[model samples]
Target: MKISRIVLASVLMVPGVVLAGENARDHFRDEARAATGELASELMQALQAAMQEGGPPEAIAVCRDRAPAIKTRLSLERGWRVSRVGTRVRNPLLGMPDAWERRGLAEFQARHADGEAYADMEKVEQVVEDGQRFNRYLRPIPLQGQCLACHGDRDQMSADIRGILDDRYPHDQAHGYQAGELRGAFTIKAPVD
Candidate 1:
């Protein structure tokens, strides 16, 4: 009778534990979405302004310079590691994914191929690495019409834009993207209490 009672008590507590876990997951997911949205909004506005000021070539500076600064500011402000990583990188140093991130990107591609809409796609997990717990999040970034100016087919790109890209990103492999294709992801890592 004692054994049965103990077992029943344990079973009853399971839902509470599970509910707590689910709540934590939901909180982390909400935080990740808000942070990612903020970064996207700021970057898009800057890019639009840059494009208006001097076309795609001048807009390159927004990505090359301003984006990193904004990301750094966000990271510092939010106490999280937030950044973007590309599936095909122009600057490998800045855009290469770690092992876990590579798996996430592959999963994203598989989901996309299976007809999942990019706008609705995201991955979130509680991961433990090197004894530290983190809430990791990834959201797909689809190439838009404006993105085609810089990331579309090299052959279709203007000579001036190509010249600037060649000069700036000599090892570029981030081109050839069509509108609505997955360009990369916004990734976040936040500590979990």
Candidate 2:
């Protein structure tokens, strides 16, 4: 009877453990995402203003100049990334996608679907390659519309966009994307001091 009672208790607690873990992950992800959204909004506005100028040349200059400032404003000043997606280049991060996941992502985009945030519940569990613990959160960036052109389809890309991408991100692998697709995760890692 005791053995059965203990077993039942463990079984009952299993769901609670899973639920708690999910809640913790959600809390952490939400905090990081909320912070990132504020910064992204500012960057978007800046990029829009720059795009208003004469041509791509003018816009590039504006974005380039402001890039450093934005970085400074947010302490992601040192470690952060901005990318676009559909060119022929392949992304290094995409390298980690499981075969089935890669196919699922592709299908999701082809259908113009953007999974709900946490649909996949991605998180930075650890940085085994290097060294990290309890000190970081990984946040994924969803591809927004502005990110579609070069990141969506090479053949479908406009000459101007391709030109801009070529000129700016020559080795870019941020292409072949659709709105709301998972672009990459912000690997937030720090020393476990």
Q: What would the per-residue lDDT of candidate 1 be over residues 118-193, giving only the tens digit for each residue?
A: 9988999889999999999999999999999889999999999999999989999999999988899999999876
Model 2 stretches astray by more than 4 angstroms:
1-31, 54-69, 76-115, 118-134
| lDDT agreement with native, every candidate | 0.92, 0.54
Candidate 1 vs. true structure, TM-score = 0.90
lDDT of 2 by residue, 48-95 (tens): 776665544555554456644654455554343322222133433323
Candidate 1, superposed: residue stretches over 4 Å from native: 1-12
Best by lDDT: 1
Lowest summed lDDT across 10 adjacent residues in model 1 is found at 93-102
| lDDT, residue 72, candidate 1 | 95
